[model samples]
Target: MTTNNNTLLCWHSKRAGVEVLVEAIKCLKNRRVLINRAIVLVQTDTDSSLYLNHEFGDIGLRFITASLENPANHNEIYQRLETSVLPELKDVANLHINVSPGTPAMHAVWLILHARGHFPSGTKLWSSQFNPDTKRTSISSVDFNVNTYLAEISAISNSEGSYALYGVDPKSAARREALATLKEFAQVPKAPLLVLGERGTGKTRLIESVVGIVKQKKVVTLACGGLDSQVVDSMLFGHVKGAFTGAETQRSGLLREAEGKVLFLDEIQDLPTSVQRKLVRVLQDNHHYYRSVGSDKEETSDFELVCASNKTIKELATTLDADFFDRISMLTITIPPLRICREDLLDDWQKIWGEVNVNPSLPKHAPTSRQLNKLLESSSLAGNLRDLKKLAFITCAYMNSYSPTEALSKAICSLQAFDDIEENEGTKFSFGDLSNTTKDELDKLFKYELARAAKRQFGTWSNAGKNLQVDQKTLQKYMKNDS
Candidate 1:
């Protein structure tokens, strides 16, 4: 619906076409005067001019096109801004964006960017909603001032709100402050950042957040601790053909892809010592030049580095040189463990539990708060959010196939099994005293757990086998032994 004179930007809704949008605008026009000009954003596949604008004869709502199958994609917002909105708004004196006629995500993008003060100086935001009782729709131009923008941003990004900012709510003051810092960091041209946290405490998740919320040339990641030194080096720095016995292809590395953007190196403590030195050199000289393992020619990749580790800067300094650590430890952010964040734990637990219980993909079972508390209290999650998710998965599996009590028992049993295996120094398990099942059942259970662990650790049997010092063929055979 068009409200202001200069420009009105909106996405074409498959459900409610421009005719309905025009009807809504007409109803709003009954109450007050309307704008004369507009610029409608449309997908490449859609001919937004098919209808509706014809009826608004005096008001020419010009159509601008961008290719977007999913309006919800954050990338679409950038595409829209670049290809449509910014180009159209160059000389426009005022603007009003009607977000009523698009996808929920489209509406959110409009509201969020405007709330973040991204639009032209006098741009106003409004929504047109049809009223069944009144059989009419009217323009509700939000005050769209600094006061409402700030207030609405907090409310909209809060847990209870319909739209979460990048799918996360900054509930506490600390988290809110961290989010602010992250956003600011995202805007900077280049800066090294460090995130210290336990596994699954959202170090990688924040990297994703930066990609979504910030405009970057590109974003790439490397799991520094997960690969062999040579493999890691080849992945980070390109290798020429014949670099090593198996190096047959001259491949471009992630560093090149990350050039002029963000390069997230996860588990930075495990990064190779040689790589650490090279990285320090990059920071020291503000240049990223590397030679392929066998090639004499040097290559350059100018990128901002962000590193994450489950160790503190002090702990890292013991293993890494002071210079390397100092360059990396420039801007460090620590994620507090869930165990210590008692204030937010219950809320987090409730949301997680509710999601599991209500999911149509799983059998429905309402777990009591007290019962859930027992599971949480007994779990040695050690503040890892992934553990809570794993527990939820286990609970659902048991609730679907067995019982809640059985779920709780299995959850505790799995933890005990891990402890026993660790104490036994990774020796084959002994099912002698385990009274729950026959040999066949025990074998099946072991296979199931092994498969699950392998998937989590390496995502493929071959990688898992290599990590576990077992042959991939052996793992494949074990998987075939059945569930």
Candidate 2:
């Protein structure tokens, strides 16, 4: 849909400054930007927005306002924006969300919109930047070059299917692809789905979202870890009253409960061989051959099966029956770890940290791109998405207690130094000036850390070497020498 008019949506935060909004519009105009629709979300107060509305009107940009009570509430903002914009996204030529004026949380929600495919394709993002050195405010378009991310926009619903990508770096191309695949499967749920990934790589989130997206009425999620074979059997296929030593009462099985709905088995690899065989029959034959403990009556239940494991389908094939592997390989979606795909993290979380506002020092000033990137690149964040989020909050906590006045730039520098030392020494180290730290020593330490990380991530040295394309022997030699 081509409109002579463009749309600009913005968030009005507590720190909304009239000058910032004015200069943003002026910059938009100076750049010959034509805008006819402007929707501003107001949360803090209306005084600045009154002037913002007037400025937008003066430029012939028809401005509208939505209210947000808490800018830091990511979920609320996400739902509100998604619900408000879906109907009109097609009609808008260029959807521009001004990032210059809202809480970081609000901005993060905006980024979520982009990450989640809520923004219509071809949308333009406008942002206001502050250059501390020059002490100037400037309006500009952010490089929202995520067209590849929008490849499956046609199959997309305005739901949170892409939520697993929430706050994730857009540069995480592989993860985005996995999200799209999951969404596609949810839309037309077919054969059994096998989600494969590293631990904490979000396999569980994908299955849960699938159930949500499909709107399954009756759902049964079973954790297949440390489960006794008999206990799992009793849990999956309800035991009769006094069915076993612990079965004091009759109960229905999860399979029976989830009939015609969804049955998500997290950590499916933990399923015992006998249990796995029974599950295979349910999927392959449309019938389950199972009896409750101390009961001969076999029961059956048909359900939409979604299984997750922190291992590859190929690796799982060795442990799982070949027939089961053949049966479930129909729809296997794998998620890559965060380290491999970390492009957009710096941009996404800088806004989130800004929104949190708990870091009083952060509210007074925005961090330079360099500071944000340094945090994103820190070796300390090896725990994937989960760890990064924790590190961000932890860093905020540290800022509040130890260095409330610390500029984000300086804080990031210290964090980098801390991680650097820890990484090199293979031990916990405190932050301090490493003035006399020699390049040779630092090099040795980095090599040791890299080798350790490589082994941890890739498992065997040979495997790591294959990925790194260095001979295993040579790689080990460098690591052993620590040079």
lDDT of each: 0.64, 0.62
Q: Write the per-residue lDDT of candidate 2 for residues 287-404, one digit (tens) a residue.
A: 6455666778777676677788887777898988777777776787887766555564553454334434454444422334555664554343554555545545555665655554
Measured against the true structure, the TM-scores of the candidates, in listed sequence, are 0.52, 0.55
On the 0 to 100 scale, the lDDT of residue 320 in model 1 is 79
Which runs of model 1 end up more than 4 angstroms from their true locations? 1-137, 140-167, 215-217, 350-368, 373-380, 401-483
User: What is the Cα root-mean-square deviation between model 2 and the actual structure?
Assistant: 14.2
Best by TM-score: 2
Clashing pairs in 2: 104-355, 105-355, 238-253
Worst 10 residues of 2 by lDDT: 151-160
